[model samples]
Target: MDKLRRVLSGQEENEERGLTSQVLDASSLSYSTRVKWFFICFVAGILLSILGTALLFIPGGGFKLFAVFYTLGNLAALGSTCFLMGPLKQLKRMFEPTRLIATIVMLLCFVLTLCAVFWWDKKPLAILFCVLQFLAMTWYSISYIPFARDAVMKCFTTCLS
Candidate 1:
């Protein structure tokens, strides 16, 4: 992060600080606050995806509810990742509106999975959907690791014991 800071400080380029690292470092909630929730939601999403896919195999599984759930959740994940593309810096944030939004998206996805899980047919499609859903889950967890590391470093340097 200091490297990023130094880099942004124009130590490398001899210019102004870049917005990329700053935004990444400035997430609304601290890394600690988000870590548990991110992992929990990501894991839950993966599980729901698998269950939904499995449900498709159950012969009556491709219900509108489940389809909506799986599709919408996956799309939401795609949108969530967009947040990663923002600049990285210390935001000195107060409330986390993004988290609330994420929660709503995740909840909707969860309900959709329930619809899929209750199905009685369509195993192959179910598995496919689950695999894709899991991919999104994995991405959310994996991509955030680097950002989390930066946040941790920020806390270490800025916090007093």
Candidate 2:
């Protein structure tokens, strides 16, 4: 009722809005617009990741290119979620107890992957970090679905047994 009235009146309630909320609201991005951007960013991220994989076949500098593109792609895909849940909320959720370790590992992998490729000049180390990044990202993503991690653990144990 109050929400409907506020919407119809073209006025925001007198509640205190944070800077992030105010900026998002000022941009006038409708829900549909946010969804559209999210998909666009997500698809672009996937394409970049695929391109990086393809570049791995190329000789000289292939590893470097792959590391850079793959890292950027992961970052883009991770950031796309911010459109659905505003940045602050997305960040808060990311660091929640359930996902803290996964998020930290994924972020650390991103940094180490870049460092291994650029500064350390270690292709194998960069590739290893990228693999870890993928696994951490997968774990982090599954954390969002109820019982997903438990199910995965069960499956792994079953396979081992």
Candidate 3:
């Protein structure tokens, strides 16, 4: 944090700093870079979800469970993005992470896929293979890196008083 103190207190000039430095404090981050990772993940999720919609158009065929699950997951995510997240309130951690409203939809998708394979109709070997694809998609969707990056950056601090 001494680097930040240096930058903030003007103990060292901004021209002497490098972009590659890890300690940015609050002022050194550019607006675009600050939010870029979230935007990329958001766009990628949308595109993967559109492919799920296209699967619905196939005739008498495959991926019904997959398409339905993906649709529900995306819609729930979109709703949470709209309603759940607000200006990062550290004091209100207890009011968040409500599964039925936010995270349970994705969990439901995973459980239902496995249940469908077992109880609905385990017809042929070919059917199992197609169902396997759905399971893969659900697993991939569920396995996500929730945070973009480390929340804080720290570097050399030997020089500060």
Candidate 4:
């Protein structure tokens, strides 16, 4: 009840953590804090995606497991992408108009794929949607990988140590 009220009121307090976190109001976040969250979320997305992909390749994994992991992976990737796009948009030369359009298209595909997963009754349509989603994901990966490689490498190194 307290948490719900805080969220609705646009102010939050994390008593267990000894923290009082404000809601993401327009004036709340600093530039560095936003950037920190972006990197953190991106790293998490990469880890989830890798784990999910590994599950897909297990020899005896059932369709249900595959779908679960795939959905989780894609959802994470989509979230990270959303975070990154904000900063990426600020780069005038690096992110051209066409690139922004492509990013928007990829976001759309991710959403459609998520919806298709819920429509399991229409197997044919689901398969087609999945295929299209895969293509869009693949295309986005080409651009996203370069940006994420450093973060992923650092995350792995930190985890190993």
Best by lDDT: 2
Model 4, C-alpha of 14: deviation from truth (Å): 31
Ranked by lDDT, the better of candidates 2 and 4 is 2
Give the alpha-carbon lDDT of every model. 0.48, 0.92, 0.45, 0.57
Cα distance off (Å), candidate 2, residue 112: 0.1
TM-score of each: 0.33, 0.86, 0.35, 0.44
In Å, residue 104's CA in model 2 sits off its true spot by: 0.4
Compose the digit string of candidate 4's lDDT tens values, residues 1-161. Answer: 56789989989866544233333233355667766777777677667656655665677633334455555666566565445445334344234653565556655665555565565544355456556656666655555456664676578799999
Q: Write the per-residue lDDT of candidate 1 for residues 1-161, one digit (tens) a residue.
A: 56788678877664555686566456556555555555555455556545544554455534544565555555444443333332121111111353334334444444444444456344445445455545444433433355764675578788955
In model 3, which runs have C-alpha deviations exceeding 4 angstroms? 1-31, 59-61, 68-102, 114-161
Candidate 4: residue 88 lDDT (0-100) = 33
lDDT of 1 at 2: 65
Taking the tens digit of each residue's C-alpha lDDT, what string does model 2 give over 1-161?
Answer: 44578889998577876997567667656899999999999998899899999998999978889999999999999999998887878999999999999999999999999999999999889999999999999999999999999999999999999
Candidate 2 regions exceeding 4 Å error are 1-21
For 81-137, candidate 3 gives per-residue lDDT tens digits of: 322233233114323553222234444444555455446644353245435544544
lDDT for model 1, please: 0.48
* Sequence-dependent TM-score of model 1: 0.33
Instruction: State the RMSD for candidate 2.
Output: 4.0
Clashes, model 1: 26
